[model samples]
Target: MNPTLHSWLERRRDWLGLAVLCAVIFVVMPLAFDVFRLNLIGKYLSYAFVAVGLVLCWGYGGILSLGQGVFFGLGGYCMAMFLKLEASDPVSTKIQSTPGIPDFMDWNQLTALPLFWEPFRHFGFAVVAVVLVPTLLALLIGIAMFKRRVGDVYFSIVTQAIAAILSILIIGQQGWTGGVNGITDLKTLLGWDIRTDSAKLILYFVTAGLLVGCIVLGRFILRSKLGRLLMAMRDKEERVRFSGYDVASFKVFVFCVAAAMSAIGGAMFTLQVGFMSPSFVGIVPSIEMVIYAAVGGRLSLLGAVYGTLLVNFGKTYFSESFPQLWLFLMGGLFIAVVMYFPNGLAGLYDSHGRKWIARLLQGRRAAAKPAPGAAAQG
Candidate 1:
C-alpha cells in the first residue's frame, strides 16, 4: 500500500464509520422496520443528539455534565409551548372558560396565557429558542463554573442539581408548565397534522438528517486545531493556560454547543413523542442520557447514537420480561462498561476491528500474488 493512501485512510477512518452509520440509520432501518418500530427508532435517535454532544463536552474537553436533560427539556418545552398554543386556539379551546389558553392552564382556572409562553406563538421564534435557550443556560453555568476553575466531580454535581431544581420547578408551576403531566395534547406543526403515519415518517427522516448533520459538525470540530486544544486542555489545563489559550472560553463554548445539540434533540422529541414533560427534565433521565453516552463510548459520536439505541432497546426488552431485575442488570452493565471497556464501544472497534480489517486486506493481497513456484510452473 502507498504510504499516502495509508495516511489518508487513517485520517479519514472515522468519517468512513460515520458514513456507514448514516446509511444504516437512514437507509437500512427505514427499509427493514415497520412504521411503529421506525418511529421508536426516531425517538431513540433524538437521544443520540445528547450523546453526540456529550462526546465533545465530556470525551474531549473532560467536562462531565449531568444536567443535559435541562437543555433537552428547555428545547422541548419551547417547541411544545408553540404547538400547545396552536392546539389551544379559540376554536379548539372554545369549551374552556379561557377559550385561547392551553387546556391544562384552563383546567387549572387560568384565564390567560403566561407572558413567557407568548413568544412561542410564533413558529420562527420557537425554532430559534430551541437552539438558543439551552445554549444560553449552558453559557451561564459554564462561565460561572469554568471562570472559577471548577471542574471534575464538582461540575457534575452542580449540573445534576440544576436538573433536579428545574424538574421541581416545572412540576410545581402546574398552571404555566402543565405540572407533572407536562405540555401534552400537541397536535400540529405550522398547521400540518403530526399524528398521521405519513407525518411520522417525515419526522423520522428529519430527525435522522439533523442527527447526521450534528455528527458531521462534530467531525469538523474534532478534526480542527481547536479540537486538539480541547484535548490538551482536558489533560493539562495549566499547560494550555501557559500556552496563552483561553481555557475558560473553550470550556464554555463546548458546553454551549453540547447544550444546543441536546436542545435540538429535545425539540425533536416533542415533535415525535407528541409531548414535553418534567418526566424527561429530571435527575434520573438526565443521568440516563449520560449513561447512553458512556455506553456508546464517549469519544465516538457515532458510537453515542448506537449506544443510545442499544441501551434503550435493552431496557425495553428486559423491563417487559423481567421488570424486577432490569435496574440490577443496567447497573451491572454500566459497571462492566467502566471496568472492562473504559473507552466504550468505539474504542473497542478501533482497537480490534481495524486490525481485523487490515489482516483481511493483507491476506487478500497475499492470495493475489503467485504462491512460491506456482508462477514458474505456469
Candidate 2:
C-alpha cells in the first residue's frame, strides 16, 4: 500500500456529508411543496432509476445501452394493466363499457377480455411480470451479444432500434394496446382511489423507498467481488477470459440487473403519473436516459440521482419557455457536456485527480523551502 496515496484518499471527503444532505432533502422538500411538489419529486426519482442502470452498464460494464426506455415502459404497461383491471369505475364510466369488460376492450369491439390480460387482474402477478419480462429479455440479449463479442457502436445501434420498434409496435396496436392514445384516465389502484392525495403520497413514498434502496444496492454491488470483476472485464475482456473467467455470464448478469432496475422505474412512473404512452418509451427517451447518466457522473452512483434532477429541471424550464426548441436545447446541452467533460461530472471528484493535485502542490512547496541539511549546518 502506498502511504501517500492512502493519506490523500482518506483526507479528501467521507460519505457522511452526502448522507446528511440526502436526509435533509428528503425531510425538507416535502414540507416546502405540499402533496403536489412531493409527488412530482417522486416521479423524478423514477428517472433516477434509469440513471442507476446506465451507470452500471456504461460506467462499469462499458456497454452502451440505449433501450432502457423500452424496459421501463414494459414494466409500466404491466402495472397499468392491473390497475385498469381493478378499476371498476373507469370501466363503468367508459361510454362503451359492458357488463364485465373495460371501456377500451369493448370500444375496440372485443367480445371478451383477452386471456393475456386475465393475469393482470391479480396485482402480484402483474408486478412480477413487469419485472421479470424485461429482465429475461435483457438476459437473452446480453448473453447472445456478449458471447459473440458484439459491443460498442454495433451494440448501441441494436439497442436503439429495439427501443424504436417497441414504441412503434405499441402505437400500432390500437385494438389491443390502445395505440397512440395510451392507457390513461386511470381511477384506482388496489382499491385505493387514485385521485386522492393520500394515494399520491403513498406512491411518492414508494418511489423514495425504491430510490434509496437502489442507491445502497448499487454501491454495495460496486464494492463487492462481482463489481471488481465487472470493472476488470470492462477494462480488458480478453485478458479476463484468459484468466479463466466467464465474461459473457458476468455481462449478462449485470445486464439483467440493469433491465430490472429500469422496469422498476417504469412501474413507479405509471403509479405516480397515472398514464403510460408510446412516446415515453421511444428511442429519444432511451438516449435521454444515457445523457442523464453521462451528465450525472457515471462512476459515482450518486451522480445519477443529481443528474436526473438537473436534467429534468432543465427540461421543465426550457420546455416552458421554448416549447418548439426544447429538444434542440437538450441536444445542445448533451453535446456541450460530451465535448467539455469526457468522463462526466464524476470525473471531477475522482480519487486519482485529487491525489495528483495534492502531490503537485506538495512538490511545489517542498521545492520552495531551504534544504534541511544546509539550515542545520548554518
Candidate 3:
C-alpha cells in the first residue's frame, strides 16, 4: 500500500487538520473582517454545504447531479412560504391564513387568506417541510432513475430537465408562487428581527457553524464503508451487480443525501439574502454546481470547498469590478484551470507547497554539507 494510504487507514489524522482549520476560521474571521464582510463570508460558507454534498455525490460516487438547484429551491421556497405567511398575517387567531382562503375556498378579493399556505405560518412545520420535501423528491426521483439504469450523459440531461421544468412552472405561476419576483421582504426568522445588524451577525455565525458541521459530517460519511460502495457502483455497476450488491439503492441514498444538503444550503442562503425567487433555483445554478465540483477536482474533499470559494469569489469580485468582462473572465479561468491543472486548485496548492518545501530542504542540506571534502579528508 502507498505510504499515505498506510498512514490514513489506521489513524485519525484528517481530524487534526480540520480542527486546526476550523479554529483558524473562527478566530480570524471575527478579527480580520468587519461584521459586514464577515457576514458575506458567512454567506459563502452557507453554500459550502452544497459543496460538501457535491464532493460526495460527484467525487466518490461518480454522479454529477445537475438538479441540486431544484432541491435548493424546494428548501428555500418552503421557508420563504412560511416567512411570507407569517409576515402577511393580519394579527389573527387563525392557525393558517392566505390572501384568498386558498384555492379550495376560492374566495373573491381574497378578503380572508389562502388555506394552502396555513401550515407554513408555524416555524416547526416550515422547518420540517424544508427538509422532508427535497429529501422525498430526491428519493422518488432516484428510485425511478437508478432502477432504470440511467447513467452518464443521460442522467445529467434528465436532472437538467427537472430543474428547467421546475423553473418554468414557477415562473408561470405569477399569482400564487410570486412568479419572477419570488418571495421577498422577509421580516424575520424564528421571531428575530432580520433588519438588525446583530441578527444578521448571528445569522452569519450560524451559517459558519453549519458549514463546518456539514464538512465534518460529510468527511465522516466519505470515509465509511458506504462511501466505498458508492465508489464501486460508480466505477463498475455491472461488476458490483455481479458481486450481488443492489446498485440502485446506493445511488438513491447518495442522491437523497445530496438533495437534503442542497435543500439545507438553500434554506440558509434564503435566510441570509432575505428572499427567494424562481431565478435562484434553475438550470444555470445547477450547472454551476457541477462546474464547481469539476473545476475543484471532484475527487478531493478540500478541493470542493476550495473550488466553490475560488469560483464564487471570482464571480463576486470580478462582476463588481468588471461587469462587462466578468463572464469572459470566469470562462477563461475555468478553461485554463481545467486544461492546465485538471486536478484543480487544491492539487495546485499541494504541488506548489511540496516544491517549496523541497527547495527549502535542499538549501538546508547544502548549508550543512560542510566543505564537501572534510569527511573524505578525515
Candidate 4:
C-alpha cells in the first residue's frame, strides 16, 4: 500500500475506535442498563476523565503526577460549594440560626457565609472555577518543579505530598469545606433538582458527551507538532533541550492541560454522585486513577476509558460478592496487568486484535473480488 494511503487508513482506524467507544457509552450502555446502573457507569466515566489525562501527561509527556485527585477534588468542591449554597436558601434552611449559610457552617456556629464561599453563589463562576482553579494550581506547580528540573520519581512524590496536604486541610476546615465529610447535600443546579431519576439520566449523557469531547481534544493534541515534541522530550529530554527547544514550557503546558481535564471529571463526579469528599482528594484515589491508566494502556486514550470501566466494574462486583477479598483481588489484577501486559489492553489489541481484524478485512476483500479471467469469458 502507498504510504499516504496507509496513513489515511490508520487515521480512519483511530476514528473508528472512537466511534465504537461512543456507541458503548451512548447507545449500548443506555439500552442495556437500568437508570441506577447507568448512573453508576456515569460515575465511573467521570473517573475516566482523569485516566484520559494521565495518558497524555504520563504516557506521552512522561509526567507522572500522583496528585491528580487534588485537582479532581478542587473541581468537585468548587461545584459542590455552588450547589450547597443553592440548597441553603432561607426557606429551606429556616430552622438553622444562619438560614442562608450551609448546614455544616451553621452547626459549626458560623453566623455568615465565608467571603470565599460567596463567589460560588453564581453558577457561572463555579463552572469557570471548576476548570480554571485546577489549571492555575497545576501551572504554579509546573513552573516551580519543571523550571527547577524536578521530575521522574521526585515529581511523583511531590504530587503525592500535595494530595495528602490538601486532604488534611479540607478535613481540618470543617466550616469551609464540610470537613471530613467533604461537601454534601448538593441538591440542585440552577433550581433544577438533580436528585430526580430523569436528571441522573440526563447527567449521564452529559458526562458521556463531555468525555467524548475530551477524547477528541486529546487526539488533536497527540496529532499535532507539540505531540511529537512531547514524545521526543519524554524519551530524550536532554537532547531536545539542547536542540533549542523550551522543554520546561512544554511540560508545564501538558501538566496544566491534564489538571484541567481532571478538574472537569471532578466537577462531573460531584454532579452525578451528589457529593464530594476528602476521600477522593487523597493518595489512594490518586494512585487508583494511575492504575486505571496503566490497565487501559497509558499510550491509548480510548483504552483509558475501557480500563476505568473494567476495573471499577470488577471492584463493584468483588466488593459485593466477596468483600473480604476485594482489595486483594484488585491488587492481584493490577499486578497481573503490570507483569504480563505491560502495555495494557491497548497493547494486546495492537499485537493480536489488529492483526485478526486486518486478516478478516482482507478475506472479505478477496471474497468480493471476481474470479480471475471471468470477464474475459463473458
Clashes of each: 0, 0, 8, 0
Clashes of 2: 0
Per-residue CA lDDT of candidate 2, range 24-121, in tens? 44777767779986787788889889899888888998888989998998988988888877774444645654546666767788867788888888
**Among all candidates shown, the one with the greatest TM-score:** 4
Candidate 1 has an lDDT of 0.92
* Comparing 1 and 2 on TM-score, the stronger one: 1
CA displacement after TM-score superposition, residue 288 of candidate 4 (Å): 0.3
- Candidates in order, TM-scores: namely 0.95, 0.86, 0.86, 0.97
What lDDT score goes with residue 50 in model 4? 97
- Stretches > 4 Å off in candidate 3: 1-13, 91-112, 354-378
> Judged by lDDT against the true structure, how good is candidate 4?
0.94
Residue range 99-168, candidate 3, lDDT tens digits: 3233222222245555667888789998999889999999988988889998778988999999999999
Model 3 weakest 10-residue run by lDDT:
100-109
For candidate 2, the lDDT comes to 0.82
Candidate with best lDDT: 4
User: Which is better, 3 or 4, measured by TM-score?
Assistant: 4
Which has the better TM-score: candidate 1, or candidate 4?
A: 4
lDDT of 4 by residue, 1-378 (tens): 346544655769889999999999999999999999999999999999999999999999999999999999999999999999999999999999879999999999999899988999999999999999999999999999999999999999999999999999999999888899878988999989999999999999999999999999999999999999999999999999999999999999999999999999999999999999999999999999999999999999999999999899999998999999999998899899899889999998888877787667767877999887996787
**Angstrom error at residue 14, model 4:** 1.4
